[model samples]
Target chain A: MKDILTIIFRLTVACLLAGLVMGTVFIATDKAKKHNVHVNEQKVMLSLLGYSAKNPAPASVAMHEVYRYLVGEGEALAMGYLLPLRDGSFSFVTIDLAGGFVAQNPVTLAAEKAGEAEARTAAIAVALGADKPLRYADQTIVVTDGGKRTAYLLPGKFPGFKTFIGAILAIDPDFSILGLEIMEHEEDPGLGAEIDQEYFKNQFKGKPLETVKKLEVVKTPLPEEYLKALEAEKSGLGAAEVASIQKQYQDKDIYALTGATISSRSVTNGVKAMVKKFAYRLAILDRVLAEQHIATPF
Target chain B: MATDKTNLQLVVNGILNENPIFRLVLSMCPAVGISTTVMNGFMLGIAVLFVQVCSSCTIALFKNVIHPRIRIPTYTLTIATWVTVIDMVLAAYLPEAYAKMGIFIKLIVAFAIITMRLEMFASKESVNASFWDGIGMGLGFMFGMMALGFVRELLGMGTLLGYDVLGFKPLLFFVLPLAGFFCVGLMMAFFNYIEIVYKRAKRA
Candidate 1:
């Protein structure tokens, strides 16, 4: 009995001592570690935005510069009006006054609307800097200076071999892809890591979203009609012919990775979904811009 | 088991005779986890060496006062404390290595080999003997892990550390955890073959 008690007592003391030492060490190093994490997060964000700097200068300086260059001198109202959803959610629906793309966050709206109406309203109130809870029908406008071209934030799910990989696909108003930034993935490195490469991502850029309707993985050389349509579209002279031309080439196939069929298909489907979602939003944006008499450069 | 052994014998024993991974087959978790890259294996090995040496000395000194029933837990606490210290120092000085090692550094607490040595040998032996034993065992673990890491990194990624040795056409399958099974299997078989030949020669 005495021996057992002694063992327990010794173990408890040892554990306490170990905890104290570890706690002290962690506390001493917490500041430096937090700074590293902050820096790394900024680096990932910059990479997603296609900024090629290997290492950003510093958080305060780099973030300020990025905001200045991207946001420009325009105040929040100059960007566009905020749309409150039925669930009391809000979006910064901006059409670029400059001749570029527009940006919208559909996921953010969907996330806010995911519960009871009252809960969602409460969440929105917190998000929008309001002390009192607002109803879904309330007309509350929060303003911000929107400078960058608006890209439709499409939810992307690529193939990860083990599971469906999720990402955020940013697309331009004309249905062309702006970027495919991976938000989450469980893919193996050197193989799935290839998805993050610029070459693969660049292929989706400038391609019409409608191309994903009948997506197929084929060899690189598309059919002759598709090539002709592409040339005609590039020339911009055959506007009348573009509809039929696009329809015929719509069923055309795209090249897939040699051995990685699942990964290829996932990317193809992910792109398709983004295109479909963006196409719907583009129509809405076009109507809103025309109705509001907003002069869009695009 | 050699009592009157010189320093060279102790080193040789660590490298060959009583290798922590192949012979004792201890601390298999970190050995496999950090063995994905040569640099990771090297860094982890050095860290383990420091912890083992320091913990062994401390445990051996306190062996007299520590009750027999609580010896295991006491040893574990000492090892855990040392590992936490090593983890902090690495995080401060070598952030890159710290990131690469990831959760494996914290896992050093559960590395059975360190605690096993402390309880089995260090607690019973003199401080000097325990110190040498710790060094020997730590080196043995390091050798095994490094060997596994070298082969895996070379074959899997076509690189040593992060350098592209061959033209960077990596065998992607080799980077996955499944690849570790094949590597350890082949190495074990090779060791067994060598052992068989050595036994046959001794009999002859």
Candidate 2:
């Protein structure tokens, strides 16, 4: 019994040392670790809207921080904050559209509860196989140009054929897709995972809201006109020809991945649902701000 | 089993005699899973190298002090601690690389080759021997994965490290896990054949 107790005591000391060592390392690096996560988060958002070409937040962003808090609060929206540039135009503004009432911190996730009325509707949509119910607990950052909202980088999640796919949707003023990027996904690498490639994502660009509303991933080859337009554009067709082709394909549904139709449809329908909610938020934010004019902070 | 072996011999043992992927046939999962792309393989190999070395050193230092009955749990704790630190460090310092290979790094904590080293070599070995053994085994694993990745990426995707290589049509079969097994087998056989030829020549 004494020998057993001694062995246990020795093992306990070893485990204690291990814990202490790890604890020390964690304490030493905890600040930098958090900073890296935050920077990466910003980098993802910036890249979604075409700010940086790669990871690591660009020095321009850190050095020339452009926006300042301009006041605004939403009545119908959960929470809102406006950041206007030095020129008195809203450069970057973030708003929480998921919650029904305004709150101080946009990070407050008061309305994300599944039992909430809004969440119930989304849960029903999810049951109907629309992308996972929109639990966008964080503020959606809107990037504006010259007082006009140019793009929105909204984070969303959708249930892929295998697992939930996390993504950031970049949409233009009229809800035309700027781009879609897969942040995290567990689909078959070559098949379902190809959704991350630019070729698959590029098809969504310039596709307007009306088309995305009824978007279906059809297995049939693209229409001859659309194919010709794509070819003509690639062959550097003349300005008139390119413009005509661009116009023709502007509102068309996206082509499905040859083998992975379900993954393709998930992204399309997921974006459609998220955008519908985002449009609602934009409308609420616009009316609320226009009535208050609180964005004009000196 | 011999503790008196020189550090160089121990290192060479890992690289040649006990190569994790080729000879010992350890860590076949990562060897096949991430070898679809040269970049992925290379990144995962580096993560493995880092974890393997750290775990080996820690295990060697505590070999005598750790009780035999609890060695397995102790080794696991040590490996898990190092892996957690690495996972955190990658996320903190190399976010982009972390984003690409973070899942792979976490997966390495459970890798057969990593734990196998502690069981077979590090537990009773000298600190220097254990460290060199890790270096050799890790490098051997890295090289093997890279070679597999190169061939798979070249033929399966017509790309090398994401760059277009030959203008030939990609062989899709080569990118699948099924082809990975075939490649590994072919490589093992080829190496064995070379060794047989060398031995015959030496005897003659």
Candidate 3:
């Protein structure tokens, strides 16, 4: 019908106009948006290690980004780490199924490009050659102060109430939790989203790997004293008092958010899995590095 | 001459009589969800206002060409485009606020209030009238959200915009979704009461 044709034509025009406007705006803001995302991520990474805008990280404190790759399948399964060397270049170190050094190849890419997954995938394909099946896994950051390794930052995700919740976990050399920062989530606001609140996030701090692995979600209400201690910075509690309170509840199960038990459990499980996997992977990487006599930035 | 007075009335009507939330009872999702905090409510309100105004203006400008049968789809596309533009702009320029309000911005496309305004008001009105209507409805929605947020935050969290006013939580139940319903209901009753009183006084 003529009427139908007119409706279709008008809708098409509207679509084209909308697309054109969005395209222009996207192009205009693309650079600034990317820059903001990068800066915000950097701020989060630094803050997890006790550095903030007020007290900037010292030059001596360097954060090195190390990427993980799961290569091959079945018996041929191997783990590869794209590590930073002291010489300002990167190397892909592979450990085979038996945890023995397989091969090491130089990965040449700009530092920023290497940090991004797509670019890293291409570089990996180039460095490892065509025959190997490999996929980019995850990335971790190592914080070193004056060449002494201090902490490790792991970005992890797990199934939340609605979708996966992304979080960054900071751990010391001994694999004790330094802090947790919820990066992104689609959980219900005023409920599961409370996981990002200070009191909830601070509960993960000071938890050792043993405690973290055994952490459970308790449905009981969070105690007032525990809440105050967890939010010590805001509560104006002294360091000694905070430490004491932390020690008291260091091994206690995580108190579930009043109405978001699933979300609380999800995060607890995520932290446990992330810590366990990182510890296992790092142990293998460290041993291989020592045996191969290869120096790493971390 | 008469047009000037009607334009002002449109705005006033939006605020008091046909308030998007209180009177018409539209977009209860964000109302109950994000109204837990004043800042959250205010941020969402601003984003909604931008999208509403932009979409209404676009609809009014092209209403002649837009076939009545397909006007709904056109309105949706217009809203979607504007939401994306606003999302990118906020993410780029106001990343700090965007950090808190990013999800809410994307969720604006689903809001019934925007579509309702386009269909009922903007589609038939002049560009100038549609613009004023957009301003009125947008402001009414914002005021409604802020009022809900104010009551919810005050009683729910014992805080106003994250500041502890009561020093301690008075009623923890107010922070829950269940309380959102009760608060909206009470507020609606209070608004109706005020309107009746004002009408009586004016008649006297």
TM-score of each: 0.53, 0.74, 0.89
B104, model 3: CA deviation in Å? 3.0
Task: Report the first chain's TM-score for all candidates.
Answer: 0.44, 0.59, 0.95
Indicate which candidate wins on DockQ: 3
Q: Between the candidate structures 1 and 3, which one is better when assessed by TM-score?
A: 3
lDDT of 1 by residue, A223-244 (tens): 4554454456345537567557
Q: What does candidate 3's lDDT look like per residue over B1-204, in tens digits?
A: 123547898888777778999999999988987788888788888888889989989888887888888878888899999999999999999999888788889999989999999999888888888887888888898899899999989988899988989998888888888889898999999999998999999999
Candidate 3 residue pairs in backbone clash: none
Q: Look at candidate 1 and give me any clashing residue pairs.
A: A76-A144, A76-A145, A101-A150, A102-A150, A102-A151, A103-A150, A103-A151, A218-A254
Model 2 stretches with alpha carbons more than 4 Å out: A1-27, A40-136, A157-164, A186-188, A219-247, A254-263, A296-298, B155-159, B162-165
By DockQ thresholds, what CAPRI class is model 3?
Answer: high
Write one digit per residue (lDDT tens) for candidate 3, span A1-298. Answer: 9988887788788889999999999999998998997788788989998888899999999888988889983457898889988888889998886888989999888887876678888888799887789988888999999999999999878888899999999999999999999988989877999999999999999998889888899988888888998888788988898899889989888999998989999999999899988998889889999898788867
lDDT of 2 by residue, A1-298 (tens): 9778877987798778878877887887787877775566667677766677645543433211212122223233223343333443332233444423332221211222422335433433333234422232434556655445567777778899899999888887788777777877888867888888755776676778888777777687766555555555455567687557767767767788778999998988888888887787667766655654545322
Interface RMSD score of candidate 1: 1.6
Per-residue error (Å), model 1, residue A180: 5.2
Residue lDDT tens for model 2, B1-204: 647878788778777777788799988988988788888878888888888899999999888888888888777788888888888777777777777888888888778898889999899887888898888888888888988898899989899988887877469899989999988899888878988999999999
Off by over 4 Å in 3: A16-31, A73-75, B1-13, B16-18, B22-25, B32-37, B155-158, B166-204
lDDT of each: 0.63, 0.71, 0.88
Q: Give the range where candidate 2 chain B is weakest over 10 consecutive residues by summed lDDT.
A: B88-97
TM-score of 1: 0.53
Worst 10 residues of 3 chain A by lDDT: A72-81
lDDT of 1 by residue, B100-161 (tens): 66456676788888888887778878888778888898888888888899888998889987
